[model samples]
Target chain A: MDTGSSPKERVVTDQDAQNITRVEELAYELKISQVMTREIRSLTPDMNMGDVLDIFRSQRVSGAPVLVNGELAGILSIEDIIRALRAVDLASPVSKYMSSQVMTIHDYDPVIEALKVFVKSNYGRLPVVDENNKLVGIITKGDITRGLLNALQHVYHEEEVIRYRASHLFEDIISDRTSLILRYRIKHGDFTHGGNASANIKRALLRLGANPQIARRCGIAIYEAEMNLIIHTNNGGTIRVEIEPHQISLEAYDDGPGIPNIQLAMQPGYSTASEEVREKGFGAGMGLVNIKRCVDDMRLESSTISGTNLRLKIFLREKDAFADVSQQGKETKK
Target chain B: MKIVELVKLVNGTVLVQGDRQDRDIKGGFGADLMSDVLASIQPDAVLLTGLCNPQVVRTAQVADVAAIVFVRGKNPPIETIRLADQEGIPLISSPYGMFELAGRLYKAGLPSFEKSVDPDCSCE
Candidate 1:
């Protein structure tokens, strides 16, 4: 019985008086293990936090399986790093806190099942072990992201996959010639959201097709802006990112009591955050210095009555100014 | 059918309104991860997805999207909508299943974004 086009059918069939059985189908099909990279990155448990950070930065991996005597010792992830960094000083060994009890998947576990596990855990990579509990391969947050990307981008052309970064959207202006201004608002007392606004803009720039170097510079500068609020302000304050297409401007403000020594605070390793924040991978006292290193122009403003505010300006030489972006893209193989 | 017409077919409310009748729609893709969306989706497009977070709108902005249609009528939080409003992207939701919505859009003459238009192959 072929119904006319105008008559809408019940897609999700259920039991009722007249059981008209129609086969249900999946919206999108899944690919086999072929399209996914299952090779899990691992490190020995005895390695220190410095090693972990090195691996994360170099491999660009979100998680690593901790191998203790060839068995699944523990799992270390970005979240774990954040926790461990907050728990101890920078020099602490990673084994002191890497999660030993990790949730993983059998080789046969469906990707959707893995997705559910990740969603529940709020963690990024999943280690794949065999029935014998031996590490075989691993799946990353990047893998899942790739899977979903392939599913949704039905119209993407080959050329689109290899695309121009600026073809997307524009980020906040940093300079008039080559930079943009970035501003972020860090809500008072909200520790979790402090550096997010700045990171969001950086990631946003990456998505919008900005050059990676520009994005990183912006991220580094704004990261300092956000951290300054968390350090001196009674409550983490506000950060604003302003981009003038060619130039970038960043401003972070806090309602807390003002900084007595602006010059000292700007020095390398000059941190006022609790020892706890330092352990968590921040409060390095090097934040302000890092910002200065990233941007071409930087400024600061502080007041005891209202709040302490810091503003930074960065100028990115135009994309045409340097023909090197395409080369980096090719190397990253994105 | 045009996205404007499809918007009427579904129960989703519009967040960021934009030109709905751009004849450039070639296909649809749905996903929750913006990172992937950022890597792919390089053409005149419409994105079908359910996640209505601020990142979704920002992803669409970075993707240079034509419109976004939320499936299963999942209206996102208000903050997400506010962000979308700022981005000038339109959102549509439908009571229809993602499968039905996809099939309907395909059958009504919209081609898959990746669907080869070369008539020599003859899949059509």
Candidate 2:
């Protein structure tokens, strides 16, 4: 049978890719102990088959591990119980009907390892043993599913809580106008932390409920400005950002070794960067140009005697506003 | 296209399988200049570059790049790999040059991530 082509052979849909990756990552990340059933019922070898059936029926469990002297000796499944009933030998001890060979999994092993064992064997459940060889729990396929769902929910909850708290910032304030200001001091030639400011800015915007497109545009714009400070200025620069309900303003400025020609610097391919800087994958002269594309307003000021200052702004449309004005308006209506 | 298929097409080796191997790459962008990449490339596109450095991962993070493919078998240093893993950005190295890798991905229907820059229209 041609068990269909590999997943790599076909283009994966966005939803499918996300779902498969989440589950696959969880399977390897979660340990068997985290998901296994801790309170498991075990049967003693000397218990009669009829008594085992009564225990199984009352507990609503189809199978259980059998212990001899507190050591795992076998597993008695529903199938074994059926065979005992077929022979009308309800009086036989569980040891006579139970499968003597048992498969066990270590509690510290990842859930994926348990899945591999389950696929290889026909057993409905595997007894989980700790490092000391003591049976700690039991695991089934259902447990894996529940474990994955809980992990997914936990991640979702964390992000949602952060977003919820941030999105409410503007709503709690009482003022004619409210704004948040963020400032960063960038050091020259600090390639190691070049984009750190921009990444944080983008994350803040996202948590504040800004749409992704707005966050991305601001992120790219600030990243370019931040790199300029690292690559060009004699000393480092300062980036200042002001965020309001309707607009965002960003400014970057540095002292001396200013742009000699602002017009030429604005051109796409113009560059004054040395060979050393070029080899490190920067100084293509597209920084200002890229920043222009992402913002609504762009300004450049320079005097070789003093310094260079660049300013950018993005205006948010009503639909794209992140502040909780609508929620405040609803409260006022009551 | 999925990142795994693109990796196979370019004869690439994964240096860091950040977050997921099956991440959906919506498009492709090839550039050695990080500024150009930050300016023009759209989000979720795979980046192809010959410059192997930690900054490449940094640029990918700021630009929301889905993955990075180091062309011409350029192995980025361990710093780059560690940064990518921390940020959950997939890193791959391809034996093929930028031109060849871009051509194959384009032929395989991976759209270009960049918007054409119009000369007449001032970006400002």
Candidate 3:
């Protein structure tokens, strides 16, 4: 009856249209080119399905546009490829499998318009065309998501830099007595949280906009001392952290069996860790040596009764002083 | 060389289905050590390994390896396959050992990272 109603066209619901309008309004200032990938990889109609798969794998792309006579012909997507792989032979020509009626967007069009097409058709990507209807670019959900993430990160880093600048502005006013103290208790044999204290200090220093090299050196020194406390001590320990404008000092004090031979303990390949510890990717016998190399000044005090007290000082006054000291320490270790 | 050609060359079986079986493999790297794989293999290179642990798949994902072919007829565990699928990497299991599989692929025109002449190549 009535020739099956002339194969009724799929209708776009009112809600879907409304959602697209909102998307357009929100992205009114953004253009398709802003988020589209310019270097598009496309497929040819004559290429066999096997060739298509080869292109997909070598290029690490899930789908690609199909071009004919230097014009936009269609799109061959991953979903279509998967379906074809299951139903058709890999030797079939891609033209027989490509979606000829491809939905495309202009490169200069508003991003919101592309958003509408995407929501209505539920497509993963859209081919971008120029005025004369030639494929110029391709845009995927990944590109849009990455663009938004980069924009958000840029804004966040700007805010952090501004905040850091303001803090330095106040430092000049209170130049005489500004200091930050951080403390953590280290439990003996608590390998589960071995480097927690040092990690926290590193995070704090980074947030405060300290030079990355200085912060890294301080972190390394604290970590080595913390490992010593956990691996070699019996009665646990404490770490006191002090951060001044020009210097960072870390002290680890433990009430456990101390090192009997300080010189031997300072050697690069000397370790007293059990066999079980060595199997866990640690206790390489380079802990103290590495600590000494990372810091500007290091002091170790140990005795059988008083346990071990280690102080690591890193200077941040001269930008290159820490690096120079690191160089010297490394040569000495060699 | 195409991955399908590799499967035929080594008499291997494709375990987990991936996007493109026809993908071209630029080179092959054979190793059982994850660290060596990480330090040496380049992106889009196929890894030939006998290790079937989840870490193998994880390493491939991090290094952007195109595919992994398990040698010695070893099948990867389900967890490893799941990870590989999630990462969009293909998994192949070869009946041949690493040395033979590598030799077969090399003979089939797949280049190695070392850039040496194929043993059969008669050089002056």
Candidate 4:
């Protein structure tokens, strides 16, 4: 998988790499207790189907767990209600309509395990139980997705701070010279602005007369590094870029919570990113690998206590610059 | 193209008309999975799908989809139509399947949803 080949020549182009990394990350092993909704909307088995429909409408939920004497008995969903509306009287007790054999999950069970249940059974929500099969909470697809949205909101907030710093700190540090240096503070969980630093780096590279290919490679490399910080690390980090006449180098150093197994993290399908991050298109476990493909040289130093530091280097030369301009000229002539 | 023109292109019936049928759609996406729509669709792109459920409307709302076109003559449930009406999203239904509708729209010069540009960007 680590063979040296151009990205375009490889079978796995970036656009269709989903099949290569179809496995779930180990990080989604969070217990349902951490993410489940405890304020459950429940119903009694004795309630009439009409009243149950009213409850569902007023509560804005399509389903609720039915209880008998404060214990889990069955699950009542909109599908069941729809079936009941067709087969039974509207005034019939919910016990007659509700699904009596409920598939349950323990609060301590991993969320991925619950996800498996959702896939297999096609149930919208599952009643969360404890050691005694007592309903403590309920986990739904909405709950999991809402958690992802909440995490994304955190990323947005970090982007605000980074934007502020870019306007204020970045302006004061730059000088008009043959060689330039720029620094950006990257925040963990800052998915919203992960690409900004790399984009800025690419712009600066282009302005400094670097070839499009070299600039694009540097951009892809740093983008991957920035994403690594946002997805993997709890503590945010900083990106330092040095652009000289012949070469460009970028260094990213985070604070702590480094990779436990760098070897596994480097694997294409191995990722620590939560399921939420994967859905948003950031954590395919391909970032580091792509970075490696883009840069001429790369180094990674990581530890659980000291955190991870990544360095990438790309060379520039007159020949590459001439080649790009000549290529553009030939295309223009055509 | 205008929404009215799009309706004609796909031989669609507008179930609930929005305020802006004259509005030009930049591109279109077709998918039945609400999650895929939520993750990938750009704002204001028309969503073509066969799954007619309340969640489809809800996903369209969350993703800021311009309008929904139910393919293969699948009319949305009353619950879904109500949600779409509440969200101010136009709902259309067509007898044509997803692929046929997409091809018609493509042939009519509408961009593929994934390949469309961000209007906010300066690039033309």
Tally clashes: model 2. Answer: 0
TM-score of each: 0.36, 0.75, 0.41, 0.37
lDDT of 2 at A333: 75
Please give the RMSD to the true structure for each candidate, in Å: 28.8, 6.6, 18.9, 19.7
- TM-score value, chain A, candidate 1: 0.45
Top of the candidates by lDDT: 2
- Per-residue lDDT tens digits for candidate 3, residues A96-142, read 88889988889888776777777788798999998887888998878
Ranking by lDDT: 2, 3, 4, 1
Cα error, candidate 1, residue A189 (Å) = 4.0
**What DockQ class does candidate 2 belong to?**
acceptable
* Candidate 1 regions with alpha-carbon error over 4 angstroms: A1-183, A320-334, B1-124
Writing each residue's lDDT as its tens digit, candidate 2 over A225-248 gives: 998999999999999999987799
TM-score of chain A of 2: 0.73
TM-score of chain B of 4: 0.87
User: Candidate 3 chain B: minimum summed lDDT over ten consecutive residues — where?
Assistant: B115-124
Per-residue lDDT, model 2, residue A8, is 38
How many clashing pairs per prediction, in order? 50, 0, 0, 0
Better model by DockQ: candidate 1 vs candidate 4: 4
Model 4 per-residue lDDT tens digits across residues A1-334: 2222222222322222211110122215457887789999899988999998898889899899998889989999999789878976888998988889999999988777788888887899999999898999999988766654555466558756665554333224433323458999989886544566776787566555556657666766676687677777777899999865446789999988988898898775567778777655556666676677667788998998899999888775657531233444454576
Every prediction: chain A TM-score = 0.45, 0.73, 0.50, 0.44
Backbone clash pairs for candidate 2 read none
Docking class of 1: incorrect
